[model samples]
Target: MKKTRIAALAAVLAFAGATLPASAQTALSENQILQSLQSAARVAPPNLSAALIANAVQEHIKNNPGMPITWTPLQLLDGLAQINVQIQFALNSDIIRPESYATIGSIADALHHPILAGYKFVVTGNTDTTGDRMKNLELSQRRANAVMNALVTVFNVDPARLEAVGLGQENLQDVQNPTDPINRRVQLINVGKYLPGK
Candidate 1:
């Protein structure tokens, strides 16, 4: 039942166009992020391991070439509750651009919300196919780390609640046009509960 709702939401997000250009992007409010994440979590599958999710992402990238990959690869994450936000970075670098700070702040705010306190999230970075796959993977990791760091250091989010991964160009939002800007995004996925015993 949960899986069904997740799939339906994912389809809507896929078709409704999740990504927006930086110039036209509006910062998602803290309440908006919180609500979307909470709704997603309510219908999310239980006990999704971070390591398993990471392995799936890695396997997807390994099996598919960056330039001609399909949205099919994203099925690994299809039933998860996730949101993609456009996070701008300096050219070929992981430095979060100033314009995106507000968006980052909203993410942090959402993470700090009381209703989401029991959840852990994965910060997955993706890149458009504009450069070497290896290089893009590295940059994406750094960018993901940067966002995680900001959430922890600046917004007081618990470090234990976040994991960062970079998928590079392996999962293109715009598979028909690999180099499309929409392919580059940061995804925040609610992986599971914060298991203190783990």
Candidate 2:
């Protein structure tokens, strides 16, 4: 199952003309991130509601706790323009590690690119299945919040354009091996356009 997911993700990235890094630690350049995002946005669903998506994830976590999520809701996002990058945090804490600042900065640059200015994004935090499920969920949310806050306050991104959600181990990238570090990641998803007049 994990291999299948990985192959599928690779295929999607390839089709989009994006290259997947060998590991999460490899830094993606601003142009690479920008191009990947732009490609994804071109085919993304129109007018997705970040609030609704956040609420659904929260509801699922509250109801299912540690259970692996089914594909129904996740499938909706599978076709969206999204990229998962590793963001290092302090052990059992939400503090952003200094080494990951470059990656975050690159993401901000991509978000600020002219082509992406009108799009809204979801910043989702995920964790490997190595700790308490509920606690992991909370920690993931805090980490996601931290990243979003940095983008808004430090990088001058519009707060209204981003939403943060934590899925913990519910949607493990490597379902067969829940403890894989690849499961621990921050996903930036281009949800839809941000129209103030709506």
Candidate 3:
């Protein structure tokens, strides 16, 4: 039994040592290395954006040459930190319109991809400075939450992996025009680790 246990430990050690890259070991201490190796053993699921999925499909087709690709669960969830989708709600209200479906659907589709199954994201709502500061903040929060709810209830995305926050007029893309429609936007940020297990 002792010999069998020793063999098992040896095999585990071998696997751990084999999987870790040399460059990764350069900065980590012995304890950190052990922790990292243990974490690495766990397979992380992919969480992706719709734009990224689309780009990945395009690349896949390019590489394969002469094959059609389906958009269902596109199996993509890597590359890029953010994808900007234009999602607009009704003016002065948090009601999402039918015209917004194309962009929102894309976002939902990305979150539904299997490659990005375990990923978490932040959906930030921003508003123009045309309204009172406090009201704008509250409005933005509502808009953000509305989008989050849509992703959860309508798209079947994992609610636990999504968070909504309101930036209000704080980070306006159009600095010159406080009332610019461009200032009113929702930004999706992938809060997941880029390389995972860092």
lDDT of each: 0.70, 0.69, 0.53
Tens-digit lDDT string for candidate 2 (6-65): 333332222111233325333344445565665653465566655666666667667664
* TM-score list, all predictions: 0.78, 0.76, 0.55
The number of clashing residue pairs in model 2 is: 0
Runs of candidate 3 with Cα error greater than 4 angstroms are 1-80, 193-198
TM accuracy, model 3: 0.55
lDDT of 1 by residue, 38-140 (tens): 5652454566654666677677767775545455546656646677777778988889898676667667766766788998888888888898888888888
Look at candidate 1 and tell me the lDDT of residue 80: 63
Task: Write down the lDDT that model 1 would get.
Answer: 0.70
Comparing 1 with 3 on lDDT, the higher-scoring candidate is 1
Superposed by TM-score, candidate 2 places the C-alpha of residue 100 at a distance from the truth, in angstroms, of 1.3
Candidate 2: Cα lDDT at 55: 65
lDDT of 2 at 192: 75
